[model samples]
Target chain A: MYIESQHNDRVREWARLKTRRGRQKSGLFLVEGERLVTELLASHVHLEALLYNAALDEPPDAVWNHPKSVDRRFVLSPQAFALIADTETPQGLIAVAAIPKVDPHYPSRVLVLDAVQDPGNVGTLIRSAEAFGFDEIVFGTGTVDPYSPKVVRASMGGLFRVRVIAADPARYLAAWRRRHAQGTIVATAADAAERCDRAALGEQLALVIGNEARGVSDALRALADRTVAIPMAGKAESLNAAMAGTILLYEAYRQAANGAT
Target chain B: MYIESQHNDRVREWARLKTRRGRQKSGLFLVEGERLVTELLASHVHLEALLYNAALDEPPDAVWNHPKSVDRRFVLSPQAFALIADTETPQGLIAVAAIPKVDPHYPSRVLVLDAVQDPGNVGTLIRSAEAFGFDEIVFGTGTVDPYSPKVVRASMGGLFRVRVIAADPARYLAAWRRRHAQGTIVATAADAAERCDRAALGEQLALVIGNEARGVSDALRALADRTVAIPMAGKAESLNAAMAGTILLYEAYRQAANGAT
Candidate 1:
């Protein structure tokens, strides 16, 4: 059925999914645009609904075969779409889903984010982690919500394959530290003497990525088993958070692929 | 002198610098925020003026030392400052400066950007370019202007150190092909047989980074002497533009430093 009224309760709830508090309160979040909605359909995710402006856009109507089990599918008026869509140029489709619920299993190689505030950075890191074989991403306290629209878009369907969870990173590491005494918990520093490649990153690893302005927090840095630095050949003070984390992931991937440290 | 009206010709002109054509007309652009403004003053950039909100923000008075030769300095009212600023939260200060005119020399190491459009991605690549010892960044046809406010902020002062220029990439690269017959002209592809690190990168290098959606254009890819793929050990089809380009830069740096091919 087509919904025309902006005052409709169903439309209001979809609009609320654009914000963090709304997503948390409703236990739902939105994945907007044709690309992301297409990814949602392809993944084994629980779809609460598929919202679209059938009169305005070609996709979802053109590409998607509505699954019989998905109980709610609504065609919205252009006005209602304008109210609910997050992107400036809405592609006339949105996928509403419960925050992805999966059994949280710790992979040997994981990327731990500590208070990363930028949504773009958070999403890019997730994409990089997946490309380099990180199986899980731990979003610790103060990190941006991975399910937010900007991050979800920036991830470019990468997060669909990687499991995401929120937990106290330091406490989580403490448990892993006891189990894998030979494992490495590496952190990047601007001035540390050992180059990232010089340090022997081993088969079992958990790398901690810090915030933009502040490096890894003092207490969190203290938890690290060792530290490594990306060698700067020029005068740049440091690489951005995303670049630094990605370089380390690449290094770990390189070492594991070849029998070299 | 304190200016209260947005109607003032000088205040109006500063507001116009927010747009690309306006900046082209005036040969100037705006840099906002305390951190960036501080970097501007410390660099040897030609300053046309300093405009600040005398009432609301602490930066213009607290951090800035009025350089004696800057021809125009105005203490603007909050309303006028609001009109002139581009950022969502206007930092109390803005610096208007001439578009940098330093002659861009071809370093042995160069990063050629081909239509990579996102301002944040452009800036982050510039930072990585600088960090990895790339001496020049060439903004080829269809790429975003390097001097825009968002790119400037995201660059975090790295663009200040590196030489930036705009040219048709194919023509510029053709000139290099004559000079360095043995030098590696690297382009990244996801399916290429040679992995990035396995490629014999040398002291002289030019790498072409393509647009986000479409990989390097057909014509530009033809100019490349060698193609190297970043080895992905997992299911991710590709990495984002910034991450992909930065990894190539890191690999180039490592090879050059280690006397390895």
Candidate 2:
């Protein structure tokens, strides 16, 4: 279908997906840019709609060939595309994908986000978590919506691969402790005595990352089996929350893969 | 001094420092919020001017007590303070500080950025570099200006602490190689066979982090003595540039401080 009017009901509805409330209500979120849209087509997630700007010479083969995955395809005029697009310069492609089902069962490696507020941080963590073999992501209270466009873009398609669940980390981790008796629940803190390099991260691990300003929440911190801090040589007070999380996750992966070496 | 108007000459000059060209011409940059402003005052760098929002109840103790460090101090009306601030809600304080001198001598460890465009990425890398003991940062041609407000803010005062030098990495590393013949220069690449965990990172090292979309630049990659890739366990194509750099820096620090294992 060709969409010329920005005010069309579908265009307005798609634009609403930009907001958290809208996405929660619609169970859909926007994925912009050609790379992300292409990745979406490859993933198991269901695509509700696909859009390409009319100005493009032609939609890429992924958009044109993927008829089975996408419920609807759109060739939108620039104005119509702009209405539903998040970027200043839309990549001439966008996709509306249904929010994938949250996996209730935990994976061997889980990344628990306590209240990581920055979308970029949340996205980067997700990307790193996926790259480092972290299979499950649990979003705790006050955490930014991982489905937000900024996060979806920043995840670089990693969002689709990982299993994400929204839960209160303290309560969930408490229950998680019973299921896997040997699992290590680690919280990252700046002042923790145990260096991440020295911490013995077991195979089944849940790493809890916290807010940018605040370290891991007290309740979650207390619940963690151990706290690991990345040893720093400089006097700078701390590392960025996301960078800290990514480094910790990498450390965990390295330990598990090759005994920390 | 009291400044009530946004059009005040000094206020306009301070506002101009928000842009790269303005900062370059004046050799000054703005640091926002009470925390960052406090950090600037604590650092050895000279403060050009200090502005505080009159409505902040009282200026922070660091601001009030540092009369010797500040060349000029002004209490600006809320509206005037807003003009020179980058954040939507001005933090009630901002400082104009002379750009600290870039140290010419190479340090034990260095982080070379090659066209890393995102300000947040650059800033996070700087913060992580400081935390992980990378003492020198060389901003390659095409890289974002480290003095930009966004980079400084994202750095969380790491910018104030590190030695930043602007130069082409290819040229700089070539010179560095001659000076320290035993030092190793490593470039991060997704496809590189050497795992970062296993890579033999010597005490003196330079890690080149590239642009968001591209890995290390071809010129710098060729200059690097060896290439290290953070081994991945999952399907993620690659980690965010900043996350990747931070992890590598942490790994290098881990090796130097506590042998890789």
Candidate 3:
């Protein structure tokens, strides 16, 4: 299929996916560049469309010939492709995939983002959470959209593997407490007294990381079983939200692995 | 006191500080925003000049009357300020500070950046290195300039506190080995067998974190006493360079602090 005009209905629609409102309305987000598109094809999510720039080199064989069927495939003129591209230097490969949804179920470990505002921080948290074995991610009020282009790119393909849901963290925390009485709900704060390395981050954990400025919300902090801080020997008042969360996740993973052995 | 034209020689010179070459030749970098300028005033680094947007509100008294004398203070026309301002929304405050120079002295802990090209990553590593008690930062051959605007911004004032130098890693590693025979020159790699947590990270250590695309340089890795990896429980290939370096630094700090007790 050829999309010759930038004003084509399909082209304009794909371009809208760059914004949060467009993504939410369509229940789809774009995966750009060869690496991300390849990851999208490998994932089980429904692929709505695939677009390649006719002006640029052809995509790799694996991408062009992926067995999974897409609803539509288009070879777009350079002008049309420019409207749909998010990056400065377009890689000429793009995919429209349904934002993943997972069934409601308790997980052994979860990551809770309480208004992590930076796209890079949110994306890094998702990537680190997945790497350290957090089975699910719950977005609290004010958190950046996990499907935002920058967040998705920063996730480094980890977004495809993890279960992400938007909901009130309070509701999830309450439900989690009811189900797993033995589990720990750990909230991180710069001022917290219990050192993270010494804290009892149990087998089942809900790690809550907060915004860069205000820190964990009062409501969330009150719900947490314990608040832990990463001990800093130097004079820095605190680490950025993503770095703090990643270090805590690693500590939790390390403790669990060591304990199991 | 008043600079009305962007074409002024001083304004042009300060504007050049936005680029790497300009910063290198001037041996100065701009610190923008209220918080950073305030930090710059408090730091021991020489404040060459201070510029304020005449159209914007007056700078806080702390900045306007900073005890550390500056070479010159300018009230710039909004157009003139735009020439020197880096951010989209200029805070009306910026300081030109000398790129800090530290006397050559051996430090207990060091962070070596080997070709880490990302400005944000380099800045973040500087922040984490300072927070985790890494005393000196050595820039390897291919590393990004620490004084780059993006890097200086991301460093969150840690750049002001830490001693940073540019030199070949092989020379530093060899000299460190000669002086402290037991010191561990640990390099990070994705494929290394020893987990970061389990590594015998000694008290005196030089931690080498490499580029995002490539791991540590083969030459640097050869000089390393040992290479350790951050063990991941989930399927993601590896953490980004800054995140990986921060985690390893935390581990090393944890060990030293615990051992000291």
Candidate 4:
């Protein structure tokens, strides 16, 4: 059916999901662009509704069989698509999907973000973690909402792949360290115990990245096995949190790859 | 002098430097925030002018006596400061400075950015390169203006510390290979000959990073001594160019540090 009326209840409901509270209450979020929609269909995510420009042809046969997928797709005018898209240029496709349930207990290299408030930085870190073979990501207090549109876009579809769990950093670290006694907990700091190159990041490890303005909290710092810093030769005060975390994650990936072969 | 008149020629001239054409023609660019102004004062850059809110106390004696110092000073009202500042929260200082000359010689562990147009990514890559000990950064054709306000802010003053040069990758790489026979050119690609983990990046290396949409150009790809991919276990199709470049730069730093001690 054509979404002809601006006052339609369904349209208003979808628009409201732009807010955090609305998204949480409905267990639904919006995804835009053809690439993201294609990936979502390929993955385990359940689609509540699919909206697209009427000019485009029907979706391929492979995407039509999912039981929970929306069948009453709306044909949006170009102006309507533009209004709904977050970007300056709308890519002509958008969908409302059920938030995929993430397994909280997944065992692998995990990244713990502590109060990193910048949405772009958090999203880029998640993308980097996924690129470097990390299986899980956890967000501590004061961090930006990972499902926010800015973070979601910055992650480049990594949100769909990595298991993201939000909780308290200190409690999560203490519990995880106690359970996996042998696993290393390396946290990035400006003034640290050892440079990352010298620190022994083991096969089972958790990397803790901290806030943009402040480094890691004192309590979380104490919980870490060791604090690792990226060595600086030039006068740069420090690297961005996402860049620092990405470097460390890739280092772990390098070490593990070398050890395996 | 107090900048009371909005129509003042000097005020209008300083404002024009925010544009690429104005910056290029006048050979002057704007740096905002207290931290970056302090960095520029400490670096080799020559400041053309320093502007700040009239309410703040005079800068320290050391800031004025730097080898390459602030040539002119102006005091503006808080409203004017906000108008001139790139960020929402102005830190009460901005400076117009001359671009320092940097040698374009073959560098050890150089970063080659191929049309990575995001200003923040460009700045972040430059900052990471400095943190990881890459000596020089070269921007390929089609890249965004490095001196843009967003790039300058995101770099966190790394622009003052690092050696930045612009060139066409095809021409630069061809000449670089001939000039330095021992150096290795490593281009990052999604599907390539070797994973970045296994590549020997410690020696004199030029790491080529590509644009957001397209991977490295064919001309540049053909010039690479080896093409390397960051291994991905998750479903993400690619990594952000800055993140990928940062990981590779840090890997080189790790190897170089290991070899040094």
Q: Which candidate leads in DockQ?
A: 3
Stretches off by above 4 angstroms in model 1 are: A3-26, A54-59, A62-64, A68-70, A77-84, A87-89, A177-181, A235-237, B2-13, B54-59, B68-71, B77-83, B177-182, B234-238
lDDT of 1 by residue, A1-261 (tens): 679988899999989988899988998988887777777777777788887786674554543565732557778888888888988888888888878876547668888999999987888888889889997898989999988989998888777778888889898788767777888898777766788877888888989988888878787789887878887787636487888888889988988887775
lDDT of 3 by residue, B44-70 (tens): 788999898999767777887776644
Ranking by lDDT: 3, 2, 1, 4
lDDT of 4 by residue, A1-261 (tens): 788655677777777777788788888888887777776777676778887765557654444444545574777766565656677776667778887666467365789999999988888888888877886888899998877778877776778877878888887777777668789888888788587766668888889998987988888888888898877665436577777777778777777876741
Q: Best candidate per TM-score, number?
A: 3
User: How much lDDT does each candidate structure score?
Assistant: 0.82, 0.86, 0.87, 0.77
- The runs of at least 3 residues in candidate 2 whose Cα sits more than 4 Å from the true structure, single-residue gaps closed, are A2-16, A51-61, A69-71, A74-93, A174-179, A259-261, B2-12, B52-61, B69-71, B75-89
- Candidates 1 and 4 compared: the better one by DockQ is 1
What are the per-model DockQ values?
0.57, 0.59, 0.63, 0.50
Chain A TM-scores, candidates in order: 0.94, 0.95, 0.96, 0.89
**Which wins on lDDT, candidate 3 or candidate 4?**
3
The collision pairs in model 4 are none
Candidate 2's residue-wise lDDT over A82-140, tens digit each? 98899988889899999987656876678999989999889888888888888789999
Model 2 over residues B127-218: C-alpha lDDT tens digits? 88888877689999999999998998988888888889999788889888877889999999888889988888888898898878877888
lDDT, model 2 = 0.86
In Å, residue B54's CA in model 3 sits off its true spot by 3.2
Worst 10 residues of 3 chain B by lDDT: B100-109
Ordered by TM-score, highest first, the candidates read 3, 1, 2, 4
Scored by lDDT, the top model is 3
For model 3 the local lDDT of residue B31 reads 91
How well does each candidate superpose onto the true structure, as a TM-score? 0.90, 0.88, 0.94, 0.84
lDDT, residue A199, model 4? 68
Residue A127 alpha-carbon offset, candidate 1, angstroms: 0.7
